[model samples]
Target: MLPLGGSHAVAEGQAVLLVAHADVTTQRLTRDTTRAIFAMRQRTWPDGQAARVFVLPNDNPVHERFVKERLAVYPHQLQLAWDRMVFSGTGQAPDRVRHQAEMLERIATTPGAMGYLEREYLDDRIQVISMD
Candidate 1:
């Protein structure tokens, strides 16, 4: 579990929560499904809505924590997968946001969007997605 009250980049530990647009029908996802979506392998939610994935920079600590702790992979591995998908024309990378604020704004406004956030950064504009 992520600890409470941290800095923007996470201070020691993170309670990064997977979040989605307020109107999304799906409330929970399995780890594999979440990983596939973020890895650019899954294109739609279980309810059949197109999945719009958002991500932070490869070097961001929050991203590192989310990728490693939640997704069970290193940041570089995810990046390499994205690079291969882009170069081979098999797939594309997620929409890259600058920070949590922008990630919140984009996911809040865009339908079928999904991303991660520090617990304190969450607002009613988005819905917290539970990992099933």
Candidate 2:
């Protein structure tokens, strides 16, 4: 878990960047598509490439901020959605990494990957997908 009160510090213009493997062709995502992919309802990008989603633990400050600020959904609500999809056998849960470093590594190496991170963690190895 992140330190107490750490999430408050993320409010100063630190929007989450939606990043993917550099080779992925898709460059942008609609708000509804982003929501569905993160919710474990959408398995592929609009261009028909597989969407590989990564995330930190639910209790992590970054995860909380990304869901609430970027997705406009609460953590618990997203968790419930994932659970429903997994149980119904219609979808699988996103890959879970322990921290931002691991998330960055996974996104950089995995093809079709998608994950959110702070601007400081981004690099040329990953392509930033604009949220439309």
Estimate TM-scores for all models: 0.90, 0.88
Candidate 1, 40-95: lDDT as tens digits: 99999999999999999999888999998779899999999999999999999999
Task: Return the lDDT, model 1, position 6.
Answer: 38
User: Ten consecutive residues with minimal summed lDDT in candidate 1?
Assistant: 1-10
Q: Rate the local accuracy (lDDT) of all candidates.
A: 0.90, 0.87
Residue lDDT tens for model 2, 1-132: 444232344554466778899988998888789999999788898889898999999998888888887788999999999899889998788999999999999999999999999878998899888876
Error of 2 at 78 (Å): 0.8
Candidate 2 residue pairs in backbone clash: none
> Model 2: residues >4 Å from true position, as ranges?
1-13
RMSD for all candidates, in order, please. Answer: 3.7, 5.4
> Candidate 2, after superposition: displacement of residue 111 in Å?
0.4
Candidate 1 lDDT score at position 23:
87
